[model samples]
Target chain A: MCSTCGCGGEDASTRVTLVDGPQPHEHPHPHDHTHDHATRTVLLEQDILAKNDLLAAANRHRLAERGITAINLMSSPGSGKTTLLERTVTDLGDRRETLVIEGDQETWLDAERIRSTGRKVVQINTGAGCHLDAEMFGRGLTELAPPDGSLVFVENVGNLVCPALFDLGESARVVIISVTEGADKPAKYPYMFRTADLVLLNKVDLLPYVDFDVDLCLDLIRRLRPDVEMLAVSATRGDGLDAWQSWLADH
Target chain B: MHELAITESIVDAIVEKVGDGPVAAVRLEIGRLSGVVTDSIRFCFGLVAAGTGLDGARLDIDEPSGRAYCRDCRREFALDDPIMLCDCGSADLDILAGQELRIVSVEVR
Candidate 1:
């Protein structure tokens, strides 16, 4: 089990320790100082997510130094992300090294599914948090210890709204939306679509049975991100899997 | 929720800067287009700050309205939604403001 995040099984490949302890603050002066009685205003002028961003940059540098490619895969609940990952890993068997860092509010299921494919996988349970921050991703990277030139997919928690706000220092961000969901998802969740490097319209096999308008969904996503690359994929039915794999290789 | 994490981040930042000193108040500037709900943060602040130096600190927030520039109209206007569009019926908008999630100042005792 992961001793740090407390989310894993006994046979887990990696144990990721998340950031939950007190920060290491360096003090220039060790001497005792007198307390002031008057109230003082400290002008910070700092961005709220600056710390996260800095940590993400560090993570990016570390990954780059090791020649590792990290992909941040995100989507809402039941977007077939895990299934897609399983298929991707299975199809790329022995051809390339793939590792997964699975994030969920409360679950070992996704990680287990990925691990069953004989690939190294780690799970992160955020408890109540909606998104995986940079520090958490860093911890995951440390535990995974991915080999050089390996592909590490960080599967984010199932939430389109919050996950888009946090940068996990990945080489690319892939947002997946299934045909079972609304066609206006891009319009409703503009932030997710706006920040995506690639959009995967999954469950194309079920398109004929569903009411989802593929063209409309693509149009809405294009409206938000004019030149974002997109693909129609059926992770369950093996449709457009080659294109997805090629895209990954190209990236 | 993400707000809980954001609140924890705020407390962590404050403690890092002030070394657990008594914080009287914290001033923040949240933008309308930042995708964060101010009420959610306010609700999570007290809980996340309970054992920290900012336990009793007043959480003061300034919400900045979103502003964007329209390329077609060659004018700036307010934007309240993430689906940005200009008054001239153009989607080519350059956001000028409203994504600010900043910690402006902190009153320490």
Candidate 2:
């Protein structure tokens, strides 16, 4: 998590701590007497994430110059992003030199899983951070040194909100939602769906067991992003894999 | 949920702008479509502002209603929700305003 924004940090996750007794607190200095200091408002007109955006542009330029297509995968926790990536690399691995940059609060599990597919992988532990910033991606790209013309996939920390505002300099943005979660997922997280170029409805094979209304889901998604493309796929059963692959190939 | 982070940015930006002295107040122009909840930002600012020069400083937010450009209608209109169709019933649109996320200024004494 960014110390400046308090968004990205190992302890960024939601928590409520209970103190056994009263805790000491910082008080304003009485001798400061800074009051009566002429107050003047300075116009800044500066974006809060200006630094992140600048780094994102740099990452974009660097990747574009090398002819690399970077993809940012976003979703809530347990949306099966890693599963989709595993299948994606397994299927598209032969066609392109695939590289995976996995972002997690604290874990090498996703990276190890990607490595098991016999592909290049790097893991970024955000500690308490909820999203992957461009600075982290820049460092990841530099360290991984992906081969020319290769496909780089950044599996952002399982978050829909924070990551939605962050631009990782990816050529494409894909948001995934599992059928088991709910059909209203898109509507519930409009910002996430609104920014995505494509929404991957993952774990479709389990749709029969779950009451996820496909049409309703599509309808809600349409309201948020009328033109955004969607593909229903079962990463485990290999259903609808061809369409997803074709879409990627076209990109 | 991410308000803590934003409040931190607000404090950090004010600190950077003044460098020294006690801040009187901080003003931000938040876009309605920026996805930040004003209530949450306000709630977090108090805690994040403590102990810093900005402590006890007032936080003011200027929120501008979101507006979008409808490609099909070729018209610009206020947008409360991005999915809302234009007057022409076309969903094809590009957001224009309501995405503003910036600090307009800080009053330092």
Best by lDDT: 1
Model 1 lDDT per residue over A151-182, tens place = 99999999999998888889999999999999
Q: Tell me the fnat of candidate 2.
A: 0.68
Model 2: per-residue lDDT, tens digit, A1-251?
23235353223311222223332223355655443444656666667776677688889999999999999999999999999999999999589899999999997999999999998898999986788989899999988999889999999999988899888899999999999898888877888988889999999999879898999998888877888999999999998899999988887
Off by over 4 Å in 2: A1-35, B73-76
TM-score for each predicted model, relative to the true structure = 0.86, 0.85
User: What is model 2's DockQ versus the real complex?
Assistant: 0.49
TM-score of 1: 0.86
What 10-residue stretch in candidate 1 chain A is worst by lDDT?
Answer: A10-19
**Candidate 1 — which residues are off by over 4 angstroms?**
A1-38, B71-74, B87-92
Which predicted model would earn the best DockQ? 1
